[model samples]
Target: MRREIGKRILINSPENENAIEVHNLHKSFRLPTERSWGLKQAIFNRLRGIKGYKDQKVLKGLNFTVKQGEFLGIVGRNGSGKSTLLKILAGIYYPEKDSTIIVNGNLVPFIELGVGFNPELTGRENVYLNGALLGFSNKEMDEMYDDIWKFAELEKFQDQKLKNYSSGMLVRLAFSIAIRAKGDILVLDEVLAVGDAAFQQKCNNYFASLKEKKQTIILVTHSMENVRRFCDRAIMIEDGKIAAEGDPSEVAEKYMSLFK
Candidate 1:
């Protein structure tokens, strides 16, 4: 089934080629037993001989195309599958059932803080580790090491164990490493929310520079202000589907309306 979906994606390619194309994407996860009403219900289901539980569909038939050098922002409330969509695009998770994801160029995803870090390792060791995870060689990390540290502002704590570092510090280091990797597609998921206000401003400026350099970025953020400032176009996902897609300002306004 996955092979057939891949074939369909290949056949639907645009003539000009896009940075990323998704067709009929769907993702779901099995609900845990604890999520059910109680142990009695779990026992009842077990006694009923139900082995496979119903899964919660996180994404449903989502389709979108991102052009080269486009800055796209994905906005949604909690559990609206915004992060799932970005993860699918980043090749972190394969969609369930019939779905297609075609992406061109290298992808750098900063989806979660401390995602690739080792708590037992020193910050310096983790720097090289994370760099390698991002497809950077030792020589490349050696060349970019100082710059990464400077950007992360963790020079003094470089030798400290990552477990000893604060969450903000971890995020700063991860963000610095990700941005320095210089991938063609950057998937940022609420990364700017981790650090201090001043650092957030710096990160914003860095994104601005990336935009000027024509890097394709897909940002999943709940911050409407950031969406309005950084993205040329924005999309809102509701119930695992595209609710709106258009100008950043207009889409953001409409997204906020749902809360009201």
Candidate 2:
């Protein structure tokens, strides 16, 4: 069966305009009910009239709008579809038909950290590679190379291969590079607190600066403290639908109540 995909439009607009507008957004995936051990087994199952898959809905008829320079937080439990919604907004997935998503201004998404890193490559080489993926020219990377390393506190590891780095180091390096990308809308997922306590302090300072500058950000996290601290508004998703929205404090309260 052919699935109809809805429209995702990008445009540049004035500061007063909404940065993102999502209407009737929905998404689903076809999950295999039975695993085919081999090609012959798959053919036999098909011949036996077994579809072997079921449709699983992740988001259902959601509607929301984010204004320019607003910091928005999305809170939900695991499997509640927060990441799926961010992926759809980042253009990595398509929504169902009749759903419309309109985005104004340039968007930078950090859905997965270190996505473009090569394990065999040196840190310096990986920096260039990741920069290229983010649309940065070699000259721009060169200008920021020292700053990036300084910020990540991995200046001595520049010549080391990425495979040798610890998980915390990798997250720090990726996050340092990601923040350098300039965009009107920033989409982040579970990246607020990374590395050791000192590193987390740095992240807090950086986010504080962004808040002070009125940067537009969409953050998906389970941290209600972060929601209250950084978000101008917040939304809570439950079972593929928006269960609560509005002021950050109210949404955070509603989210915490779900566990009780």
Candidate 3:
């Protein structure tokens, strides 16, 4: 059923057990007008009454639904609004008029590297901070603290500032925390692998476990292999709208055919 809230619409999923539902979603970004990068030029532009920005629509009218425990893959070329859609689903961005979004469960998103970590803080401190963001109490984090550090292989560096860690180390720690931060729906973007080959294998196994358990996951990635390997369904986005959606292999093939 679809209802309206002002200009926006609320689309309830047809599947009573859906994990996500979206209807006529739209998003746009306002970019500051480019001018000479100095206070003098800034003052000049303002004095002349030049419009200070332009709007770029990143997502057009889009609609979709994800059933409970579904592993859904999203794919698109660069600048196709795949990331924007993910952020909307994650509640980091709101849609334009008449756009609808619904999430039926606790959602945990690992959409970007270092999404919830403070660079100036020690790894240990950042862990607690991120845990809190995921709604874990300090006591609950303490119970799982050792496991998180151990998985990231940064037990010795937990006291070190995150800014000092290498890119690989940072992702490792972030990935470790995301896995431990359990939620009913998991949203990930281009994070299929991390660390060395051994760790990559571990990640594969972890995905397998999740698949077996029927965990609800939404992934955005360029890796067709991962999409085919893990996702039971997939969607291709083009120009901020869904171009195709259905079986994982079929959607992946359609995405590849665009190159041909």
Candidate 4:
């Protein structure tokens, strides 16, 4: 699918120019209904021509391409499939047949904070575990351990079990690890701030630094302010389809119009 992104022609852009591309993407979920629970009930429902489940269509055929060094924001309201779409791009979920997702570089997605975190493990142990999940060797994790500890400001709490840490403490540790384990393309699902006021400020600054580095980013967020402030382009999704796309400011304005 070809579309004009500002003055550039997306389809004609060189492969190296695009950090990511998605085409003809579709997704749906089969939600269980009453008769789906019991074997006998399911059989009876099937006999009566009932599928015993409701198909929840989440994403329609979506198409877009993210150029290298572009900070693209994905904006949507609740239940609009924003997170679902991100997961599909992160390879956590798959779309239907004929869907195409192409990535030009290594992708690191911070879609869920601390997805593999173990509450029973000590803060230090969890760091290694999470790093391994990110495909880092223990040796590599060891090399970066001190910096992670220092960035999180949880050096003193390293010995403590994660369950004992405050919510803010957990966010600090997780966010610290995510940024340290960098990749060619970064996908963030939220505002990247969920802790104390000071730490939130640090998070903002970190994002600013990333912007200065010309990092390619795909951010899925509800914050229009961030869309306008950080994104060169933004796309708004509604009912599992692209509702609007292009300049972040214009997209943000279209998104706001729905509520007015």
Top candidate (TM-score): 2
For 10-118, candidate 2 gives per-residue lDDT tens digits of 9897754799999999999988777666677678778998767788999998999999989999999999999999999999998889999999999999898778899
Q: Rate the local accuracy (lDDT) of all candidates.
A: 0.83, 0.93, 0.84, 0.85
Candidate 3 per-residue lDDT over residues 82-111, each given as its tens digit: 999888888777677688787877788877
Tens digit of per-residue lDDT, candidate 1, span 129-170: 988888899999999999999998989999999999988889
Question: What is the full ranking by lDDT, best candidate first?
Answer: 2, 4, 3, 1
Among residues 3 or more apart in sequence or in different chains, the pairs in candidate 1 whose N, CA or C atoms overlap within 3 Å are none
**Residue-level lDDT for 154 in candidate 2:** 95
Clash list (residue pairs), candidate 4: none
Clashes of each: 0, 0, 0, 0
- Poorest lDDT segment (10 consecutive residues) of candidate 4: 1-10
What are the TM-scores, per candidate, against the unseen true structure? 0.86, 0.95, 0.86, 0.90
* Candidate 2 lDDT for residue 205: 92
